[model samples]
Target: MSQIISGLGGQSLYGGLNGINSSSAIISNTQFNNPLESTVDYSALIRVLVTILQQLLSQSSDNTTRPTPTVADTSNNSQPFNRSNNFNTASNNNLLSAASNQNSEDDRNIDFNILSATQRDQLGMTPRERAILHLWGRQVISAGKQDGGIYTNVLGADGTGTNWANKAEVELVKELRAAEKQQFGGDTGIFLDQLYFNLVKEKTGVDMSTRYANRPVHFSSGAVSIITDINLLHQRTGLTEFEQGALRLFGHDPLINGKFDGSVLDYTISNNNALDGSRNSSGNPIDKVVRQLLNEDIQDDGQRNGSSLMKSVITILDRLYSSN
Candidate 1:
């Protein structure tokens, strides 16, 4: 056995099995003669061989069949993350759409054509009356008064009695002169002084005189007198014939009262609130007639062409003077 072992390159039994030399497991000559010692070496070698066989079996099992390395499918693994990202993107888009819709709703809530009750109360006039006065004031400002002449003469009271078109025209002219003197401080140049004062008060909340003190040229002017002449006033004001006629009839309708009432003149010229047909204080659609008039005047292109505005004034007059 020793010769066979030496023939195998003097390797121990355990070393031979593992393709290595082990001096401790090598059978010695003296240990082989002692049967007990030889038996002890063989037993130790058997134990080591058993341990190596067990290790080899474990290694073989590990090498042949691993747990398949549990390789993750990246495509499947990223699905939840991708889904999370998509969900987040969709949520953001929904939020943006909601915000845009809210903004549009807010924009739709604004109604520029309608005036509030507080605004009507502060202006102390009906919407129709305010619109009429605003147009009239603009006309007066455009057709300035005469310079260096009796204001009454400029208003068709030349005493020649030739300029008077009719008794009605003559009466209207007299009422205008009286209103200019009594309410407007005889400053016929500043015909609609109250309108100007109200506009200044609305804008600056200051006295009209204080605003125009440094700029008196803007306060009053003598450019072209046209208040007494309807045709001339129309030319200056760009008001249509029907509109001018409506305003004239509003001032003096012989069919309604048959005479010029100073109270009517005052109410027409002053900023006093109109009691009749002024119930649409909130500018709501509850007053369909007034709301329709406002819609036509403010929303329609006919307002620019003077057709709708004429209709609005005519409707108001028709309501007031039922005979017309």
Candidate 2:
């Protein structure tokens, strides 16, 4: 894996991915590494994303591209992350322009939210970004009820959060922590901190730093109901070969995408029997998901035509590498 990343080191992955013929197959770019020989062609995976990205960017002028406007242009496309401290009053309205970027990056918004008031605002995340942070944290650990009403009085709000959509997925974990040994019906297992591992990681992108996001959630029931999507428990209780390999590289397990009964998280989150796949909505593998999608680049290589996403990746990777 290291060798693959190393070979592509300083190389613009977005360029290569974006360069794939827009008319060609998306799966062609997303091909994977060899499980047996560590020989994988990331191009195939890139293709899948390229198709999506192409579709997205192509819609810049086509209002009919989808039912709604491209998220960045949509005033309602708020990110699910709620790390209040880092959000700037400015990011709420405008998206960082993509002209500074090359090509591959014009895909998703990479901005991140503030950690807190006193926290040095590092990444400068945008609004939709804030939502992803919130989404990831909610799915990973149980969520407490949030008094989202604070946003209700705002200029615009969309789709009402139904009971299932509004309830916390990991609410059970919190309840279990306070439960007695006998309340569990068996030996006590799992720690509270462990429950929030990816939650914190997703929020801050610091790889499970001791510092935690301090947002408080207020439940609608007046009591935060603790319920593990029974389906999530079943899938995570055992690991798959692909999942195990991902965990080894990324340091965490992925979430269940469908229930044993074969239901999607959309249904479950809104009150079905399945857990959403552990991945962020972007469909990136859960474990390897990047935290701050920093919106810049460092490689001056003329060989590269930096796309928006490429710039974000390069800038962030460079920043992290240099900080060390």
Candidate 3:
């Protein structure tokens, strides 16, 4: 597990504190001499870690209703923790109204089932999407990252993002819109755009005007690397299904430009203007973790930065174990 956190071949993916030593060498010139013992069993590893967190969360609470453990919203809400009553049902039913209420009764028992691969597809998420949800939730809950629980963080506060789908899922909606644009033209594409905008605003209380107003809502700088890979592979041949999916997930269209749209290039003027600012509206908690992992070099400020995903994950595990 530490290998996963610290990374292999002396490349310390799990960096240290913020101010320890910014200039210290994190990796050596050993080259690829130390290959991994074997490919990491991501599925099994994630399940074990998530299960441990679930057990700890369950044990910590004495609620009569048996609330499901959820991620807290990091933006807009100042509360340390936001709870989801159950994952089987939408935590924010108000967002979905009849849609979630109607479906929740049927899906209410499906929350715990998400850990199983067989049940995963039934939840309408791709492997990557579910993996992001599982790993991010585990990082937040079990790792004790200050972003807190699943309900507010990953799901989006008031269940706007989490209602029926998550931030990852919302991102997929944008991709779907992009696909519709390619297939139907700009008018139809804008229709889909409005559809999602209304849905997100109606349910989650977030609007793009507000979300992107102060801070540019780029998922992470990692998308730049991903887009480069996609453009390179796409020019060679038709993309693989997974690759195509990645393109959509990142809001890119091969049919259009090899480069990303202005939507993708939206940059923040300052920390105050950024979506993570004091008034962030649509920053996804899971996306934050994913971005951190994908972004380059966490050691710039050294070990003092508690925001590092490695430190966050380690802190979560430590808290759960100590509490037990």
Candidate 4:
């Protein structure tokens, strides 16, 4: 019987499915030493193999354009990363103008509580944005309920809080930690700050860090609730219009659009199954929203242009918040 043996250095492999003792299976090195032997096209063979390997690599790669990473200067590495130049002068001026005009309108006799679509249009906002503002206002009024209450309460004189307020920041921090783990494989402890900044840029195409520099890291349920309070939103700082829109639509809007199965207001948070393709499960509304938003960029890069549903919502909100 013929045995398969390891060849010496510089010897090529030779084997075949023949009789166990067949000499035809044995390839002698002397075959190549023969001067009359014809030469094989080794270069052509190599090129063909290389081409196959390259085609395989191309096939395995995801057929989508990945999102471009935003690079910020981390000069003061000692302290937590606090970015500068969060937004451009144009957006800042527009926000300031809108806020100022909205405040002035509030001072007038016409009640915002009863403002119609026409009235909102006169204020330079779309019906959808106006609806979001009104819904947000109602949520603020129901602050003691499951969705929690206002965090800053700039509009209210008492500045009272819901049962969820005391733990809102803590809960938000926990939510971010979990999201960081799921999205990027680990929590950076600075995920919230960085994400908030990114959201600002995504929404307004400007960097806006100073507005939220001293703001508390924890976000209230209202910040993530589907229904938001327009008056309370105006009173608060730190959050950009884009971030606010994301909170409004994350998991909260499914019911409004007939997409969510359960109750409209989910009081007790559970596993938060929104981003995991299981939308029925309950958890902190804010957490679910954050996960849903961040997961869009993490899962596939091709859809990044419209990455999260929040991106579309933010575009609408921007027009509402704009001077035009």
Candidate 5:
């Protein structure tokens, strides 16, 4: 039995159990002889075998629970967790930011001060009043440029052969004529005021007629001259003296030495040209004239000094008469 144990490398097993000196020696010395005749310590052998089994079980448990080391994947195929979701989130954020910025820019571009009723009140004018002045100015300028009879009546001798109107007025008249041609009713008698009001409503969403129930309506008459019509307009509208004068300048040719030489329209256009060229310089007569007309403070600098309403009117005039 000892020879059989030696052949099975039992010595090596005993060498592995180094700390159990007594068990190692006993295990090494135990011999299994013939079962019927030999005296064998089965209990000592049982104790050594139990100790070996316990140590083997402990080693197996340690191996089973031990954590394994891992290396990070650096291959091209590797991607972050939730990679697609993360990319979509970032892209949506960028688009939202861009849209917000664009909306802010658009808001800045629109002049809210001009559109707001409360702001217009601060300038001592209602929106309807402002719209009336704008309409009258535009019409007078437009009528001043018409050919033949209408031109002669509106601007007098000054309208004889001169093309004193701006490009916008010319284009406006062209468009109006085109629209008139397409009308179902024939020859509606040159309703420029209607066209002007229609444009104002379309652009601003404010119907001038609704705002001022008694607003003027344009009508053609051979009995009344343009001057008589304008005087009646001032009386009916209760316009200030300055407002009346401004309207007259557009509708009438100014008399020099009791004879008409040049209209206020002529001087206004010339002065506007000078003002445009020398915007930073001072002492243009038209600037002083406008300030006086609006009863605004006059400054030496070329920069405009007026109430908000005054500034707005001047800005409209500038745009209407500008060569560029």
Candidate 6:
């Protein structure tokens, strides 16, 4: 209950120049100071968080079947009690009450299931694959004094790059696919990629040919700071998670080569060649909150200025059908 971000999470406690800004910040910075915390145990933290979520979801599901109890109408409690009659209305009332509470909780759980699954798929992840997407490590690379010694704007632990696992999606998929085919193949990222692609298409009819056209979809900026540490779990948090995810995506995977592969880069220049007529078929919904966050990072200039906050949400669908 200390509210400290502990264990194996990728979140850094460094306050940048903010200096001791929050209690959570202080705890995280301590880890940074200690060389022992340099190791990144992704499996441990992921398992812990996933277990907690599963337990909560199970409880919620159980609540849905709980029987509702009627409130005691105490107006007729004058009846005498015998050894057998001890099972009075009071006991019955308590049972009913408990059941009703459970039912209410179940409904909430159902809603959460839908929402979480939807968001994950939109961002390209499956139900089982939905989690803190990150290739976490203790690599704390500060931006140096020129970039403020720590990109304060880049959210998440050790800058924004350490949070989300927006690793070259295609390369990751290839690795996973190879794992599946070969004995050394690890089907982890590949299965995740497939699951995500299916979910988004089911939810939204939009396709890659329509959305990206020829444009490249970079999650964030910088050579290594493309993926946001915001995690798919909290990407819908808007100014909080939205910005963070964008940072992670672009920062970790910028269009360094300026070359766009049709399958790899969904956006393109259609025959019409117009931005306004373009319809993004992918799952990335430009919510009001997302707009606000992007506005903070992006500027309104034809020159395409600012910290290049125009981040892209790389849909997993492309990889599933990409020629590359």
TM-score of each: 0.21, 0.18, 0.18, 0.21, 0.25, 0.21
Candidate 5 ranges with C-alpha deviation above 4 Å: 1-191, 198-209, 212-218, 221-241, 244-289, 292-324
Task: Rate residue 138 of model 3 by lDDT.
Answer: 30
> How much lDDT does each candidate structure score?
0.35, 0.30, 0.31, 0.35, 0.35, 0.29
Candidate 3 residue lDDT tens string, 1-324: 343432332232233222212111222212334457555445754654455445445544533366453332312222322232233233322212321222222122222222344343433334544433333333222222211222233334343454534455455444543454465542122233344334335433546334322321111111111122334434533343232222222321100111111111111112222222213323223233334433412453443222233333333334432342
Model 3 spans with C-alpha error above 4 angstroms: 1-187, 209-228, 233-324
Model 6: how far is 204 from its true place, Å? 0.6
Q: Give Cα distance to truth, residue 160, candidate 4, Å.
A: 15
TM-score of 6: 0.21
Q: RMSDs, each prediction?
A: 29.5, 27.9, 29.8, 22.5, 26.4, 32.7
Q: Among these predicted structures, which one has the highest TM-score?
A: 5
lDDT per residue for candidate 2 within 1-324, as digits (tens), equals: 333432332233333333434324433343356567644455755654566556545544453445655534442435423222232434433333331222112112222222232121222333233332333333222222222222221111332333333233224323433342344332122233334344435533544324323422232212222233433422543333323222221211111110111111112121111122232222323222221111111233422222222333223323322332
Q: How many clashes in each candidate?
A: 0, 40, 29, 14, 0, 37
TM-score of 5: 0.25
How many clashing pairs in candidate 3? 29
For model 5, residues 1-324, the per-residue Cα lDDT tens digits are 554433333333433433445555565586556687757778867776677667655555655655553111211112222212122222322222222232221111112222334432332333443433343453443333111123233333442323633333334434444464476222222445455345445434546434433333233221123332334544644443444444434222211111111222222322322211113122222334444633432243333322323333334434322311
Residue 216 in model 4: shift from native, Å?
18
Q: What is the per-residue lDDT of model 6 for residues 195-285, given as tens digits with 9 covering 90 to 100?
A: 3334334433435334434332212223223222334323322223443334333322211111111111111112011111123212333
Which scores greater on lDDT, model 4 or model 6?
4
